[model samples]
Target chain A: MSIDWQPFLLTLQLALATTLILFVIGIPLAAFLAFTRFRFKAIPEAIIGLPLVLPPSVLGFYLLLLLSPASVFGHWLDTWFNVRLLFTFWGLVAGSVIYSLPFMVQPVQAGLQSLPLSLRHASYTLGKSRWQTFIHVLLPNIKPSLITGIVLSFAHTIGEFGLVLMIGGNLPGKTQTASIAIYDEVESLNYATAHVYAAILLLFSFAILLLVYSIRKKLQGSITGL
Target chain B: MIRINITKQLRLAHENTQLSIGTTIPSNTITAIYGPSGAGKTTLLKILAGLVQPEQGAVEVNGRIWLDTARRVCLPPQQRSIGFVFQEYALFPHMTVQQNLQFAAGKNGDKSYIDKLLHLVKMEAFIHAKPSQLSGGQQQRIALIRALVRKPQLLLLDEPLSALDDAMRHELRTELYHIQQQLQITTLLVSHDISEVYTLASNLIHLEHGKVVFQGEPQQLFGAASLSSTLQLTGEVLQVIPDGAIYTVEVLTGKNIIRVTAGEHDIAKLQTGDKVCLFVKAYTIALKKMNG
Candidate 1:
C-alpha cells in the first residue's frame, strides 16, 4: 500500500497555525494571570484551566452547544456576521486551543512563578512601567519556558484526536487532521497506510521533543554558566 | 531633599501595629533602618519609595508630593523617581549582567554607559555572565548599580548585604557609602545588623514592632538607654558551637553565660579561656543563672 501524504501536510499546517495562535493569545494571558492580583481572578483562571482536567469530549460538547443556533452566543455570532464555528478549520483551531490549554499555560506559569519577585520590584522602583519591565526583564528570563510551552502545545495539538473528532468529524480538506486521517485509514483496514502515518508521527514527535530539550539544556547551561 | 510623612495605625487588639513616617532622609546620607525582623523596616522603606499605600499619610521628595494618602493623591512606584534594591538581588536571571544594566538604563544601542556601570560595581569582568552564574556578592553589586543606573531622586536598599559574605559585604558597604556620597543620591538602607548600621548609617531609625522606637544617629542609638541596655554586657568566650547558619558564641562571665551571634572571623579568634567583653543590650540578655 502506498502512503497518502496529503493528510500529513494538512496536519503540519494545522499544528503550525494552532501553535502560532496560541502563542499570540497564551503568553500575555499567562503573564497576567501569573503576576496580577485582581478581583474575580480565580474565576478566569478556573475557566482557563477548566480544559486541563475536563475530558476533551466534555469541552467539545460545551463548545458545540455554545455554537449551536439555539444558544444566545451562537445567535450573537450569527447576528454579528453570520459566523458559524461548528465544523470549520477555525472551529478546529478553537477546539485545539482549548484542548491544549494546560500545555500552553503550565510551563508559562511555572516560568513566571520561578522568577524572583525582586526583578519586577527592581524594575518598578527604577520608574519602569509594568509593560516595560515585562518586555525587557521578564520576557528574556522566561524565554526557555515560553519555548517549552509552544513546542509542547504544538506537538500535543498535532496528536489530539478526541477534540478534533467531536468538533471536526473527520471532514477531509476542511478539518480532518493527520490523526483523523490515520484513524480513517485504520478503520478502512489499511494497516500499512496506518503504520506509515503512525511511524511518521512517532518519529516526528520524538524529533520535536529532542529539539526542544536540547535547546532547553543549552539555555539552562548558559544561564548557570555550566 | 527627600521628605516622608505618613501615619498608619494597626490595632489588632491582640497585637498593636502602628507605623508613622515622620522623617526626612538628609541629602547624600545613607539613613539606615535598623530593627529586628517584622519590625516594619521594609515597610518604612516601601512607604518612602511609594510602593506602599498608607490609609492616611503622605510622602514628599524634593518638596514635591509623591504620595498624599489623606488628600487621595498617590503616585505609583513606577512614576516615583527612586532607585530600589530588593533583598534578593533581583537581577534578571535570563539577561546577561550587561543586559541587566542596559535594561535598567533603557538604552537601545548605547553600551558605554553600561560599561561604566559594570565598572562602578566592579563587575566589568562578568559582563556576559547571567545573574544565576554570578555569586551572591556579584549579584548584590549588580542589583545596587542597577538601581543607580537610572540616577533617580533617591536610593533605597532593603538588606542588600545580608546575603553576602563579610569581606564582600564590608567592602561593598564602603563602596556604597562612597558612591552615595559621590553621586549625592539620598539613600536609605534597611538591616537588622547593628554593625552595618554602625558602618554605613549616618542616621538610624530603630523600629520595634512597626513603630519607630528611636530615630537618630547610630552614635545616639548606641547611647540610647533601650539599645545600650540590651546590647552591652561583660563576659568571655565559654564555647563556640557552629550550627552552620551562625556560630553560637557563648561568653562566660563569673556565673553568667552570654551567647551572641558572631561571624566566622570572630568565632575563629575565640577560645575557651580568652577573656572578652560582650556589649549586649539588656533586652537581649537572657537571665537564667546557668550555673545554679
Candidate 2:
C-alpha cells in the first residue's frame, strides 16, 4: 500500500508557522505577565492559562463561531483583508496557537520571573534601555525556558487533533493535518495507514521530548554550576 | 555638590516607614550613607540613580537636575549618567568580564578606556572569564569597574563589599578607595558596617528609620565623640567571653579583630553584631612611620 505524504508535510508546515508566530508574540506577553504589577493582571493571566485546563473542543467551538463566515468578525475579515479563516490551513494555525499558548507562555513567564531583578536593574543603570536589557541581558539568561517554550509549542501544534478537526475540517491537502489524516484513514478502515501515521507521530514526539529534556538538563546544570 | 530633598512612603515588612531625607553631599567625594537595616539607604541610592521614584523630591547632581517631582521631570536611569553597583555584584553571568564592561561602555565606548579600567582593577588576566567562573571578590571588582567604565557623573554602591569575607572585604575596600580617588567621581555608598564607612567615606549621611539624622564628615559623627583619644576604632561585636568578674569581648574592627576588656555594664548591653566604639588612649598605642 502506498502512503500519501501530503498531510505530514502540511502538518510540519502548520507547526512551524504556529511556533514562529507564537515565539514572536509570546516573549513580550510573557515578559509583561512576569513583570507587570497591574491590578487586573489576574484577568489576563487567567485568560492565557485557560487552554491548559479547558478541553480542546470547547476552545475549538468558540473559535469556530468566531471565525465562521456567518459571524460578524469573520465577515469583517473577509471584507477588509479578503481573508477566510474557517476550514483553512491558516485557521488550523490560529486554533493551534490559541490552544498551545499556555505551553509557550507559562515556561517563558516562569523563566523571566526566576531571574534576579538586579540583572535588569544593572543593565538599566549602565545606560541600557528597557528593550536592550530585555533582549541582551534577560533573554540570554533564560535560554532553557525559551527552548522549552519553542519545543512545546511545536510539538503541541503537531499533535493537535480536536481543535484542528473543528476549525479545519478534513479537506485533503489544504487542511488535512497528519492527525486528521490518521483519523480519516481509521474511519475508512485503513488500519495500515493509521498505524504508520501513529507510529511516526509517536516516535517524533518522543524524540522532541527527549531533546527538550536533555537540553534542559544541560542548561540547568550549567546555570547552577555557574 | 549633590543636593537631595525627598520624601517617600515605604511599606516595610513590620511597619510603614517614611523616608524623609534632605542633605547636601560634596561633589567628587565618597559619601557613605550609614544606617541600620530598613533605613531606606538602598532606596535613596536608587532614587538618586532614577531607578526608584520619590513621592516628592528634587535631586540636583553637580548642578544638573536629575529629578524634580513638582516639575514632573525625572530623568530615566539611562539618561541619568549614573553607574550603580548592587549588593550582590549583579554581573551578567552570560558575559565575560570584558563583555560586561563593553556593554556598560555603550556603542561609542572607548576600547582603550575599557582596557584601562580592567588593568586598573588588575582584572586584565580574567578579561575573557565569565562572572560564574570568577570568585565573589573577582566579580565584585568587575562590577565596580563596570560601573565606572561609563565615566558616570554619579556612582552609587549598595553595600558593594557586604558579600565578601573579612579579608576580601578589607582588600577590595582599599582598592575601591583608590579607584574613587583616582576617578574623582561623586559616589554614594550604602553600608551598615561602621568600620567600612570610617575607612572609605570622606563625608557621611547617617540615616535612622529613613531620616537623615546626621550629615557631616565621618570624623564628625564617629570621631568627635572621643576628643581625648588619639586613635578611635569602631567595630561589630563578634563574641563575648566571660572570665571571672571581667568580660573579654571580641570585636571585628577594620583589618584586625581585637578582644577588648569590658566591664559588667558594658557586657550587659553588648550583643553579637552590636556596633561598639573603642577609644585607645595615645599612651597605650604605638605609632611608627615605615620607609617606602
Candidate 3:
C-alpha cells in the first residue's frame, strides 16, 4: 500500500503560508507588545496569548463560527470577495495561524523586550526615524528570536490537528493535512499507510526541532562568548 | 547659546522629588554636569537630547525652540541633530565598527569623513570588526565617532569613558578635549570624577538632589576653595628655583618647609612671599593661589 502524497504536500503549503502570514503580522504585533506603554496594553496582550493555554478545539470552534457564512464577517467576505472561508484551503491556513500564534509571537516579543533600551535611544539620537531604527538596529539584533519564531510557527502549523479539523475538515488534496491523513488512515485500519505517514512526520518534526535547539544553543554561545 | 529650563517630578524609593535645572550653556564650550548617582545628571542629558520629556520646560538651541511644554511643542529625538554617547557605548552589536558609523552617518555623510574619523581615533584597522570583538576602549572610540558622524550641533556625553581603565580614560579625555576644540561643537558631559570633569570641562554645573547647586568655572568648583576644604595645607612660597624646565618650589607650611615640584605654567606667576594652598591629587602635589 503506497502512502498518498497529497496530504503531505498540502501540509507543507499550509504551514508555509501560515508561517509567512504570521511573519508579516507577528513582527508588528510583537513590537507593539514589546515597546508600547499604554494603560490597558495587557488586555490585547492576553488576547494574543490566549491560544497558548486555551484548548485547540475551543479555539477551532470559535474560528469555525467566525468563518461560517452565517456570521457577519464571513458574509461580508463572501459577498464582497466571492470567497467562502469554511472548509477552504485558506480556512485551514487561518485556523493554523491562530492556533500557532503564540509560537510566533512569544519568541519575537521576548527578543525585542530583551534588547537594551539604549540601542534604540542611540539610533534615535543619531537622527534615524523609528522605522529606520526598527529595520536597521532592532531587527538585526533580534535575528535569533526571529528564526526561533519562524521555525516554531512552521512546525506547529504542520502538526496541528484539532483546529484544522474544526475549520477545514478532511477534504482530499485541499485541506487534509499529513496529521489528518494519518488519523484517517489509522481509523480505517490502513496501518501500513498510517505508519508511513506517521514515521515521516515524526522524523521531520524531530529533525526540525533538533535544528532549532542547536541553532538557539549556538546563538546563546556566540552572544555570551561562552 | 543653548538655554534649558526644565522641571520634572521624580519618584524615588521613599519620596517624590523634583528635578529643576535652569541654565544656559555657551556655544562652542564643553559644559560638564557633575553630580553623584541619583542626582539627575543622566536625566538632564536625556532631557536635552529629547529622550526624556520634562514636565514643564523649554529648551532653546541657537534660537530654535526644541521643546516648550506649555506651548505643546516637543520635537522627537529623530528631528534633533544631537549626538549622544551613552555610558555603555550603545554600539549596534550586529554591525561592524564601520557599519555602525555608516548607519549613523545617513545619506548626507560621506565615506571620506568616516575614514577620517576612524583615522583620528586610530581605529581604522578595526573598522571591519564588530563591537563585541573589540575592547571596551575600542568600543567607546567607535561610539564617539558614530556620534560625530552626523556633525550634530549639540553633543551629549553621558560618562562615555567611565568604563575604561585610568590610562585609557586620560588618553581619551585629552583626545575628547582636542576633538571638541577642533570641531567647536557645543557639548554637555556628565561625569562623577572631579579630575575628569576638570580636565575636559571649561564650565561646570554641579547637581545635588536633583537641583543645580552651583554653576561656574571648573576651577571654582574643584580648585583651591574646594581642595582646601578637603586634604589641603596652607603654605607660603619661600623660594622658587628653576631646574631646567621644571620649577622646584619650597613652601613653608607653618614649621615644615615642603618641597614640591611644579610645572612651569603653575610656577610662572608665583614668587617669594606669595601665599598658596598645596593640594595633593593622585600622589602629585599642586599649588593654587590662596584666598585672603
- DockQ of every candidate structure: 0.72, 0.71, 0.49
Alpha-carbon deviation at A181 in model 3, angstroms: 1.1
Q: What is the per-residue lDDT of model 1 for residues B1-292, given as tens digits with 9 covering 90 to 100?
A: 7677777765554776777767777777888998877677887888777767777877888889988866789888888888899888888776788777777777553567667767777788988887877788888888888888877888899999988888888888888887877787888899998778988888888888776788888988665554445555456677888988788888886567777788888778788878786653355566676462
Off by over 4 Å in 3: A217-226, B226-292
Report the C-alpha lDDT of model 1 over A62-101, residue by residue, as the tens digit.
8888887679998898889888888888888888887887
lDDT of 2 by residue, B1-292 (tens): 9899999998899998999998898889999999988999999999998889999999998889999999999999999988899999999988888889899898899999999988888989998888888999999999999998888988999999999998899999999999998999989999999889999999999999999899888999877756664678878899999979999999998768998998898898889999998876684555699684
**Who wins the DockQ comparison?**
1
What TM-score does candidate 3 reach? Answer: 0.86
Between the candidate structures 2 and 3, which one is better when assessed by lDDT?
Answer: 2
TM-score of each: 0.84, 0.90, 0.86
Ranking by lDDT: 2, 3, 1
Reference-based lDDT, residue B81, model 3: 73
Q: State the lDDT of candidate 2 residue by residue for A40-68, as single tens digits.
A: 99999999999988989999999999998
After superposition, the stretches of candidate 1 with alpha carbons farther than 4 Å from their true spots are: A69-72, B9-16, B108-121, B223-292
